[model samples]
Every structure is written in C-alpha cells, then in structure tokens.
Target: MMTSKNLLELFTQTRSDSEKICQPLQTEDYVVQPIVDVSPPKWHLGHTTWFFEEFLLAPNFPGYQRFHEQYAYVFNSYYESIGKRVVRTDRGNLSRPSVQEVYEYRKHVTKLMQELISKHWNKDWNPVLEIGIHHEKQHQELLLTDIKYILGNNPLQPIYGAVSNEVLIENSEREFIEIKDGIYHIGHNSESFCYDNELPRHRVFLEPYAISSTLVTNGEWLEFMDDGGYSNTLLWHTEGWDWVKKNDIISPMYWFKNENGIWSQYLLSGSQAIDPKAAVTHISYYEAFAYAQWKGLRLPTEFEWEVAQSKINHGNRWEWTESAYLPYPNYQKPDGALGEYNGKFMVNQKVLRGSSIATPANHARLTYRNFFHAPLRWQFTSLRLAKSL
Candidate 1:
C-alpha cells in the first residue's frame, strides 16, 4: 500500500500524463473519431476525469459537487449500472462540451480528489483510487493510438509527432526457448495493485512447448504476404476468412504502397519507410492467427505465454494469444460497481498478453491480460510464434 502523500503525487502525475499526451494535437485533432474503436482525444480526457468523479468523488467525498450534472450521461462508458450513456458510434459528433469545458471538468474533479485525500484518508478507498489511476493509464495508451488513427486515416497524412529513433535491441536473431512439461503457477500472485481478472492465482498444466525468442518482424510478415498469405483461406479461421474478404485486408493496418512501388507504414511522426527489423505491429487477432498458421506454428495459450514471458522480449507490442478470455476456476466478482470492471467483459473476446511501445512503463506487468474482439485492428497489437513439442 502507498502512503496517502505518495498516492497523491502519483495521482497528480497520472492525470498530468494524460494532458501531456494531448500536447501535440491541434484543437481539431481532439474531436474526430475515425472509428468506433477509437474515442476522441477530448472525450478520453473527460471520460478519465469522469471516472474519478463518478467512482471516488461522488460517493466518498463530503460536499462533493459535480462539474456538470449531465456530464455523466455523456461520458459513461459501458457501465450499465452507472447510467445510460451516449452511444459509442456517435461520440465523435459531440462538440458542445467543448475542449475547454472538459479541461475545467478535469480540474474540478481533481481538486476535490486531492482535498479529500489530504483531509481524510481511508484504507478502503485506496484500491478504488488505484484502479482509477491505472484506468487512466490505459486510456493514455488509447489516446495515442486513437490520435494516430485520426491523423493516419486522414488523406492529408498529417504528422502527430517526430519519428522516435529508439534503439530497442541490436540483435534480432530468431531462437526458440524450450519449456519442459509441468504445472506452472499463473496469474497475479502479489499483494501489489492488479486487476481482479488477474487474481485468484491458479495452476495450469502445460506440455513441452517452444516459443520464439523475439517478435515477428515486418520483414517476416512481408514474406508471408509475398507468398500469398492473404489469398489462402486455409490459413485463416472461418470468421477470420470472412473478415479478410469483407475488409480486403492484405497487410497490417496503416501499411500502404507508394506510387514508387515501395511499401511504407504510417507512424505518429509521419509516413516513413517500413523498418523491416522492427516488430510487426497494428495487426488483429485474425492476422496473427493466420500468420501462425502460415508458418505451421501456433500462438501460445495464455498459460504458455505467462510461463515463457520472462525469457522473451515483450512490452514492444501487445502479443495476441490463442486463448479465449474467460474466468479462472472458482472466480467471483466483488459485490459492487467495482465488480463491473473486468468480470463482465470476459466473454466473446480473445486474450492478448504483453504490452506495446505506447504502454506506460509502470503499467506493464507479466500478469496483465489485454483483450479485444478478433476483428479490431486499430491498436498497437503484434504477434510471436509458439508450438507444442
């Protein structure tokens, strides 16, 4: 547990980080939602603020007043227990709240939160507050990805930031690390902050399996494409094949062929030559599955993924897995609105492990489970190959 003062500092920093992510955006950049999976930048700013107000401030703080009574209906996301919310598809159409008003809403909520912590601290409230901070960090990543989609999808091809020349690793050798068959303990086991879905640490049996030492690179994916990976339906699942045909997806999202007949990818900075050595990213679960099938390999089950995580490179991009998102044995949701957080979304979603480059450094953990629908490809998602021995 963190001291109230330390938590306060953390709270302040977490809130400020969201604003920092938006610094590069023009006012116009904050309002467009190119797709339903992406939320407007300004809406992200308000929705995160609204989380604290709705969860922490209204119930716990004395004399807490809402910045706007109707903001709840506008910002609520997927919490049916909270109240009705604006439909997701229409989020981009909301312009009346205005960016300036949303900033004020954040300030109003943040001030009360800080004041409540200073005057009165409750141990019970600590977990709720921690979840809110982590939730904002989740949106911080979304803010950047959404911003990229907003700009990347634009015909003008505007730049969001300068090309980041990060020296990740010089060695890109491909090797498979072998894990012997055994029962391994998986899921979050610590007392530290973790989402409920990662809890109830359980045992899972695994057969001998070998996992790639590194992520699949753009060069490797291109080879799959060169060999007509897209046209071959046998490599894809039934739903995945339909998705491929319906969307006409030939390569990863944001990939394009220039008039000069060269492949390039859009980045936050601008469109640039695809660095073949960099880990291939922005792929959906369907694509990752097909790529694994093409190589005569398989994606690791979540248990296999957790077992081999320490030996492989992660946090460069979110690695999709073959496992479905489901509750562990004897899993139960807590007794209130907080229970609604992770438990409800455990169906109809595929599990993704690891983290992305856009993920906040403090936010990534070995036990973290990120999930998305198989067809959603707008996030910074990637893949690694694995197979049972």
Candidate 2:
C-alpha cells in the first residue's frame, strides 16, 4: 500500500507522462482514428481525465464543481451505466473539443485531484485513486500505440519521437523448457494492485509440456511467409483463413518490401530494415495460431505460461495463449460501473500473457490477463511456441 502523499506524487507524474507522450505529435495527429479499435490520442487524454473527474473528484470531493457539464458526454467510453456518449467509431469525429481544449480539461481535472488528495486523504480514497492511476497508465500505453498506428498508416510515414520500435535479439537459439504435468496455482496472489480479471487465484491442471525459451523472431516468421505460410489453409483456423483471404494479409502489420525486395518496417522513429533477430510483433492471434501449427507446435495455455513464466524470458511482447478469457473459480464481479470493466468483455477474446514494448512500466504482472478478439493485430502482440510431450 502506498501513502497518500506517495500516491499523490505518482498521480502527478502519471498525468504528466500522458501529456509527454503527446508532445511529439502535431495538433492534427491527435484526432485521427484510422481504425475502430484505436482511439484518437486527444480522446485518450480526455477519457482518462474524465475517469478521475467522474469517479473520484465528483463523488468524494466536497463542493467539487465539474470542469464542464458537457465534457462527460463527450468523453464517456464504453460504460453503459455512465449514460450515453460518443459512439466508438465516431470518437475521431469529435473535433469541437480542440486538442488545446482537451489539454485544458486534463489540467483542470488534475488540479482538483491534487487538491482532493492533499487536503482530505481518506483510507477509502486510496483504492479508487490507485485504480485511477493504473487506469491512466493503461491509457498511456494505448496513447503511444495509437500514435504509431496513426503515423504508420499515413503515406508520409512521419516520425513521432526518438523512440525505436526495433528490438534486437541477443540470442537467436531457441530452446524449450519442459514442465511436468501437475496441478498449479495461477492468477494474481499478490497484495499489490491488479485488475479484477486476475483475482481469486485458483488451481488448474496441466499436461506435461515444453514452452519456448524465447519469442519467435522476424527471421523465423519470414521463413513461414517464404514457405507460403499465409497461403496454406491447412495451417490456419477456418475463421483465420477467411480473415487472411478477406484482408490479403501477406505479412505482419508495418512490414513492407522495398524495390530491391529487402524487408523494412515502419517504426515510431522512422522506417527501417526489419531486424530478423528481433521478436516478431503486430501479429494477430489467428496468425500466431497458424504459425504454431506450421511448426507442429501449439500455443501454451495461460496456466502453462504462468507456471513456467519464471523459467523463461518474457515481457518483450504479449505472448498469445490458447486459453479463452474467462473468470476463475469463485470470481466475483464488483458491483456497479466498475464491474463492467473486465467481466463484460470476457467472451470471444483470447487471453494474452505477459507485456509488450508499448506496455507502460509496472502496468503488467505475471497474472495479468490481456485479451483481444482474434483478428485485431494493431497492438504490439506476438507469440512463443509450445508443445505437448
């Protein structure tokens, strides 16, 4: 548990970090949403501020006045319980709230939050405040990735910052660490902050298996592509095959072959040659599954990944799991608006274990369950291979 003063310091830093992420962007970059899955950068800023204002400042702070009455309807995300707001796809259409205006809104809410935490520190305020901070951290990751999508998709291929997306692999050798079959306890067992989905640590049975010691690399994926991995229907799930054919996905997102046929990828810094040894990223779960199938291997179940996590190197990218996003035994959803956070989205999504390059610091844990629909590849998602003994 953090002291209110410590949390307040962190809150101040976290709020500033979000703005720092957007500092490299031109005003026009903040409002474009290329796809439905990605939110505008300005929207992320306002939405995170709206979270603090709606959940903490308004409810807990005595005589707290809203910064703007209409701001709630403009920034409200997927919370049905929170009343009507901008539709998901139309988020980019909200040009009325200028980028400067969104920043002002953030400044307004952040000042009130600081005052609330400094003057009247409550024991109960700790949890909600912590949630708000972590919630902003989550948005911080999204803000960076969304920025990449916006710039990467543009024909000009503008650079956002001095950050590099290419991660060089120190070792190319692949090994599989074997784990014996047994009952293993999984999920978050710590006292630290975790999302509700990782709660109620529970037991799971697993068969003997071996999981990869390292993530699959761009060079390895290139072999799959060279061998017509995208064209082979036998290696893909039915829906995955349909997605491939429909979208003509010949290579991972951000990949392109120059006139000389050399592979290069767009990074936040700029376009650069693909680092063959770097861990492959921006692949959908369907693509991950197909690659695993091509190798006569399979994705590790979330349980297998958790029990064997200590034995392997991770955190380079979000490793896909064979597990579905579901509640653990005796899992209980918190009542009211917060309940809708993780519980309601549990269906039709695959579980991804570990963190990505774009993931914010201290935001991911061993038990963290990140999920997305099988076809969404805009995120910095990747895979490691596993096989039954």
lDDT of 1 by residue, 1-389 (tens): 88889789889999999999999888988899888999999999999999999998999888877889999999998888889999999899999699989988988888889998888779789988899999999999899888888999999989887634321332767899999999999989877788888878999999999999898888999999999999999999999999999989999999999888889988887787778887787899999999999999999998999999889877777889999999988788977878899999999999999877778857888999999999987888888899889
* C-alpha lDDT of residue 365 in model 2: 91
**Which candidate number maximizes lDDT?**
2
| Candidate 1 deviant stretches above 4 angstroms | 163-170
Candidate 2 lDDT score at position 283: 95
**For each candidate, what is the lDDT?**
0.88, 0.90
Evaluate residue 203 in candidate 1 and report its C-alpha lDDT on the 0 to 100 scale: 94
TM-score for each model: 0.97, 0.98
Off by over 4 Å in 2: none
Candidate 2 per-residue lDDT over residues 108-127, each given as its tens digit: 99998999999976978788
Model 2 residue pairs with clashes: none
Q: Model 1 reaches what TM-score against the true structure? A: 0.97
